[model samples]
Target: MRFRMALYPLLGDLKTICLTLAYLYGLTVYDASYLALGKLLSGDVYTADGKSSKRRRGAK
Candidate 1:
């Protein structure tokens, strides 16, 4: 009975850790995707449809 009682809290903690890890993994994946999209659609690289005419380094 005592062991079972102790196991309950341990199981709860394990579940919390698993959920936290899943959340962090999701956040990491989302961050990577956001950066990839930002790079892909960034300034005059793929199109001239940008909203600004700002100059970049080493540009004429």
Candidate 2:
């Protein structure tokens, strides 16, 4: 399987985003931003094991 930079169009500035997400989540910025952007655009993300998303009780 391959992953594309699909979040770029949705979120313009990636370099800054990487740093921001990394700092917030204590993850490698690029990797954290990639996953963050995916979740923002798609509402969920798929990993090797399964899928995950922000669990909001009243949002959905």
Candidate 3:
């Protein structure tokens, strides 16, 4: 079996975007970080938290 890992630095722009997402979505910075990263990578974000998932779906 093989696995791959990629490291991404959380720089100023990403940090600022996370902070903005946190404020706009009423989410903690921690949660917003996931969203920010997903947006940056043009990928989807999946969460175990049902409430958060619901909120995200509703936002779309």
Ranking by lDDT: 3, 2, 1
All candidates: TM-score: 0.25, 0.41, 0.74
| Global lDDT of model 1 | 0.33
Tens digits of per-residue lDDT, candidate 3, 1-60, equal 999978766788778878888888788788788888888878888889987776556322
Q: List candidate 2 stretches off by more than 4 Å.
A: 1-12, 36-44, 49-60
Worst 10-residue lDDT window for candidate 1 reads 51-60
lDDT for 25 (candidate 3):
76
Better of 1 and 3 by TM-score: 3
Candidate 1 C-alpha lDDT tens digits along 1-60: 355422222234444443444354443332333323433446233324233213211121
Q: What global local distance difference test value does model 3 have? A: 0.77
Q: What TM-score does candidate 3 reach?
A: 0.74
Error of 2 at 23 (Å): 0.3
RMSD of 3: 2.0
- For lDDT, candidate 1 versus 3, the one ahead is 3
Could you tell me which residue pairs clash in candidate 2?
none
Reference-based lDDT, each prediction = 0.33, 0.49, 0.77
